[model samples]
Target: MKIRDKILSGILLVLIGVLLGMILMFFRQGTFSFDLAEVKVTEVNRSESPIWTDDELEKIDDRFVFKTIAKTVTPSVVYIETLINARDRREMSPGEEEDGGNFWDRYLPRTRTVGSGVIITADGYILTNNHVIESAVRDGINVTLDDKRTFDARVVGRDPSTDLAVLKIDAENLQNAVIGNSDRLEVGEWVLAIGNPFRLRSTVTAGIVSALSREVQIIDDLRRIESFIQTDAAINRGNSGGALVNTSGELIGINTAIATQTGSYQGYGFAVPSNLALKIARDIIEFGEVKRGLLGVTIESVTASTARRAGLNEISGVLIIDTVEDGAAAKAGVQSSDIILKVNGVAVSESNQLQEKVAMFRPDDQVTLTIWRDREELETDVVLEEMQPIVQETQTIPENNFDEEQLGPEPEMWEEIPGDENSGIEQQSFRELGFSIRALATPEDPDRFNLYLHRVQRGSEAWNRGLREGGEITEINGNRVHTLDEVEKEITDSLKNHRSLTFKIRTGQGTDGYYQLF
Candidate 1:
């Protein structure tokens, strides 16, 4: 009976061992049957790739290629910094400044603005937007590279018409991005945008060219020229003068403007075509300004409504609204109410085309213009003329019997008011003055800032002595004058001594003269 019990125990142990082996095999799963078909999961082990396909191989190749090119071009590009200052107009009451009421009136100071620029040359020429240096505020320009090296820069020249400027830095061993022909660019081409957006230095964005030959009204009718390269790349306020490069890392344009109702990027971007920018930059560097031919005709676009009202056969093309007197168009006999259909065989569909066409010529370059007058197609050859240097006229007011308040709200009083007849000092009369001048404020300028004294009346004692308005009188009747206070003190001393003040003055380029303030 004992032998039989031992044999039974051994059989039970063997059965238990077989059950454990089955459970272990189930957890190790390699093959599974889905309704009778085997799905060899093969236990992937997650980290190791069990299958390789041809499509995946191609994607891997493309990614590596793009990554290589991106890494190569990044080092060659750079970021620029520009500092601009302009008049900040804010009115304030008397005693706001230390020099509360001087020069017969109290004053307010101007303000400063800061911005960015782009480096286009290795030996130090940089291109930027004109609005960056709008005011007489052209100081503290700097250029920085991707490696964090910074250098000082100077304004070489600026063109307000195209909203472009040139800057120079005194540095060597720099990288210049390759410039490509923008004329060869096509819509839907891939491009990259590089700029300092919102002070974030050296950022790059990518997009496709959405359009070409875009016309935009930058300024309100005063001066407008349109030549834009539209792209989907995002651009902002600080992106002016940035590079819009092709896939090959060749610069094709300068990112300048964006179309957005909210004053921010909304998918549309505009760039200055590189061909035009190259010409402008060359001219500015050589001539210290841009010199281009003008057609002298106020051009307009023919809309469907205008075509209906005017009974036009064709609904497209630019119309000559008015030819400037004594201008190229005027000399060529182009008249108002005439329509311009083409130039050099290129169809002009809008007024902006006329500007772009004419700007392509130099002062002496002549071009053929086609027009539609009286329903007849006519052609005329015009000899372009160089635009002369513009002279800005200043204002000068008559020094009539006046008080101090109209001179701009001065609290200090010297004489009693004489009813409404005495309407303070007259403003600067631009036609009579012949110079652009403004007062210097305390904090804005403070040091070596320029100020103009009252002008020398034509028949007054000052003019008879050849003393001019710009003349700087430092001493009166043997009394010294430095600040405006000294000027007042000297005048008081002269009045106290009952003698005319003989003033020693500094003139143009430090030429000195003497005049008696009788």
Candidate 2:
């Protein structure tokens, strides 16, 4: 009986312990339920419409025109992204040189620039600005279409003179823009600017043609041809190489630049005419280079003063300042101080107009120039010559080569000459001209001193007039300057006489550019 009671008590203790553990676990976990929740969903009404209104289908309004242009032209525009290596990196503005920066910044590994391009061929021939992809690395250009497809692009050719370049891709059946004649485009006509501005893809803006044949002096190349179509369209940095089309969705120009002080759109925009762009594109694709015809004459605008001085009946031509020796113009009996009244029967009042007209032809092509000489108009046939490339050797001037004491005229020679305030003549100083010269010594003839520009202050009058550092000054005021003294003397005499000073300069790039200072 006693053994049976002990076994029963141990069994009871084990059962109680197990029950206590279960209770503790239930208390820690709080509560539990066995429930299955059900979901209930209801359907909404949906339908399709096939009805159309005659007003919506036939009535064409300004909004309809813009919508049609956007739908037709947006697909033709593309986004271009380029990877430029450090060695080939250049400033965004060609006319502006990179002057100040940390040494390490110059050696950055890589940089990227974004712009836009227009498809010009069904097989993926794209037209863009030279500055857009000029120095990109090999296999670094990526073009994105409106459909979000991206492809690698290859450069077909580039023309720095016109700031135009052609690109090729592997894609086919691309949407291409229909090019229209820019010559027929007139001021006050409605136009559209299409581009990927500020990374906003396929942006379209509307404006009117503000002006024509404008020379803004933005191109840095001495042979640069800048006869841009000016407009009030809003264009930003990334809009370079984009398409400027008419209301009919015809491509009429290539958006190139903007006149902005804050680096954003402020009303003014410029474009390369489609006529010139198409010509350059065709040449680049056919010959791998722009076969530009050279007229062999340096010309300027015939202003009222110039017309009065030359005894012209009207101010309606370009003044021929000089002619290339043995060139086509010289061979055709063209002389300095003559006025070019018309080119091939087209009246040209500005130098840019003449340049644009002549740039349309090829080498060996003949052009008739209506020239005014000795108060009479005479027609002369000038066969355009093949343009010869200007080869320039990068010249490095030795530090401290200029001796301030030995070069330039005495300070007393440039005394401030007071001008009559009543006559509206303002006193001008030679020192404020923004440039200085020094005598360069050559190994061939150490005794023969050659005048070279020492420094040209940026944003100064001289710089804006296309004077740059390291340029060789061959002549000043039509007089050959072998020494800095001659340059100083010529400049002093001109400043004192209140006359314009003409400088014949061989630029650092070894191209000849005539600069005039008032």
> How accurate locally, in lDDT, is each candidate?
0.64, 0.82
Shift in Å, residue 487, candidate 2: 11
> Which candidate ranks first by TM-score, i.e. highest?
2
Off by over 4 Å in 2: 1-64, 86-109, 311-313, 392-433, 437-501, 504-518
Clashing pairs in 2: none
Question: Please, what are the lDDT tens digits per residue for candidate 2 over residues 384-466?
Answer: 99987753211222223445344444343344445343432223244679766666555576545666665665556676566
lDDT of candidate 1 over 80-172, digit per residue (tens): 654432212334345555333344332334444334555567787877777655543345566677778877777889877678888887877
